[model samples]
Target: MRYESIVRNTEFSRAYRRGKSYVSPFLVTYVLRRKRGGVRLGITTSKKIGGAVQRVRARRVIREAYYAMGLNEEQSVDLVFVARTATTRVKMQKVEKAMRAHLTAAGLLSR
Candidate 1:
């Protein structure tokens, strides 16, 4: 299924300021519970990671991995995945694993 995306600057800022965060070699995740709406996701890749191509690849990998998780829920939450340098080189499964770990830590996923 497709995900509702976190598109506004305010939405992203709110998650960063109030969310619980988890870090892995491949990704950094920030999660916040929302009062209403479905799950909204954001993937961030910066110039520190690489040039345009690498940045795009990182976002794509994170998106695909997130999609594979099937974390659909009626409960509203915002998840932000920040791509690290390693994210560009790693396979999608690794990214997915990292994401699962973070979400689990945040209690978005079951143990």
Candidate 2:
């Protein structure tokens, strides 16, 4: 959905602490809360990934893949996508696959 909803969540801090799960190749964490009526997504890249450009690129890649996969809006899912060092040089497909796999595992994706 819109970036504002994802960025301005009041319960993000608590949700972050309570619901944190990881998967191979990336760290998948999320908090499902009752919000307006849709899902908002956030992407995070630490310095471990790289400098500003690298971090920005990582965010852009994930955001692009998320949009490309038509998963920009999800109901009740506040997602935080963290990129690991391995993702720095990887292609968008891998990132998309990892994200999709995680989403599927989380039961957010249907078939």
Per-candidate Cα lDDT values, in order, are 0.91, 0.70
lDDT of candidate 1 at residue 102, scale 0 to 100: 90
**What TM-score do all the candidates reach, one by one?**
0.95, 0.80
Local lDDT at 65 for model 1: 96
Give all candidate RMSDs, comma-separated: 0.9, 2.5
Which window of ten consecutive residues has the lowest lDDT sum in model 1?
A: 66-75
lDDT of 1 by residue, 11-92 (tens): 8989999999999999999999988878888988889999999999999999999889889677689899999999999999
lDDT of 2 by residue, 1-111 (tens): 354346654655655776656565744556454557577677777798989988887888888768766754647666777777777688888888887877777777776
Error of 2 at 95 (Å): 0.4
Could you give me the TM-score of model 2 versus the true structure?
Answer: 0.80
Per candidate, the number of residue pairs that clash is: 0, 0
RMSD of 1: 0.9
